[model samples]
Target: MADNATSNRKRCSLNAFISHAANTTDVVPEFPARNGPQRLVAAATKQPKRRQKVILEPGHSALDWARLKSSGKDLRGVPQLGRYTLTEIKEHRTENDAWTALNGKVYNMTSYVKFHPGGVKDVMRIAGRDGTKLFMLTHSWVNFEFMLDACLVGFLVPE
Candidate 1:
């Protein structure tokens, strides 16, 4: 009879110890806290920030462009918005003063060429012409509207 009682006590003690250990995991961490899963998902989903092969000059980074946009510089060049014929737009082709149309909106792309991810050559190719097709083909993801809002010259009207 005594042996039976001792056996039962040992079994009960083992179960109690297991239960305590299981419950203690909630209070005492088994492993360190980490966002491992979140970081993996983000790394998989996030697109590359820069697609350019050429390195940008100092003070001409993407952040610099954002700062330049807000700096109150007259990026538009013109006093007010007005329709521009393709002929007139062609005249402003130089890197010093470039104008191009994308999605029917004309933007003064002079200052932006330096900030371009694809370097000046890529942006210069679109100068003084309708770059909607080329721009879309190269970097369709680019949000030109938002990027060039401050540099907006006007709409591109038929000549």
Candidate 2:
């Protein structure tokens, strides 16, 4: 009887100790007091650091031909011969002489028509017309300016 009671007491004590330890093990410590240099260091470490400002070197402007020509200054001696009106652009609508107007620029796409990823028919459909909307709709992500840079015949003059 006495031994049974002692065993029960030991079991109860062990259970109580285990419960207390479980509770303590799961608890997170409170943050350190907020007035010291430790707190400042903690706060600083928690925040994201400001990134250094990137100083990019001046590079080529893709579509800003006016700026490029003006900056060169000596471009005045280079006689510009290929400015075309809409009527003139319309004259070159065949596959052999395919010209396309996109974003106020005229591109002679005769050679490019054969190599078009979408098909020559797509290029032919927009020949000699302002295909800006269709071009953006079909290939808004394509860098047409860069791709057609070499094919650029001239700027489109107003009707």
Best by TM-score: 1
Segments in model 2 whose C-alpha atoms lie over 4 Å from true places? 1-81
What's the CA error at residue 87 for candidate 1, in Å? 0.5
Expressed as tens digits, the lDDT of each residue in 1-159 for candidate 1 is: 999999999999999999998878466543333556766677689696785498899999999999999999999999999899999999989999999999999999998999998899878999999999999988899899999999999999998
| Model 2 clashing residue pairs (backbone) | none
TM-scores for every predicted model: 0.67, 0.49
Residues 81-111 of candidate 2 have per-residue lDDT tens digits of 4777889888888888888788988887775
lDDT of candidate 2 at residue 90, scale 0 to 100: 88
Model 2 weakest lDDT span, ten residues long: 54-63
Worst 10 residues of 1 by lDDT: 25-34
Return the top candidate by lDDT: 1
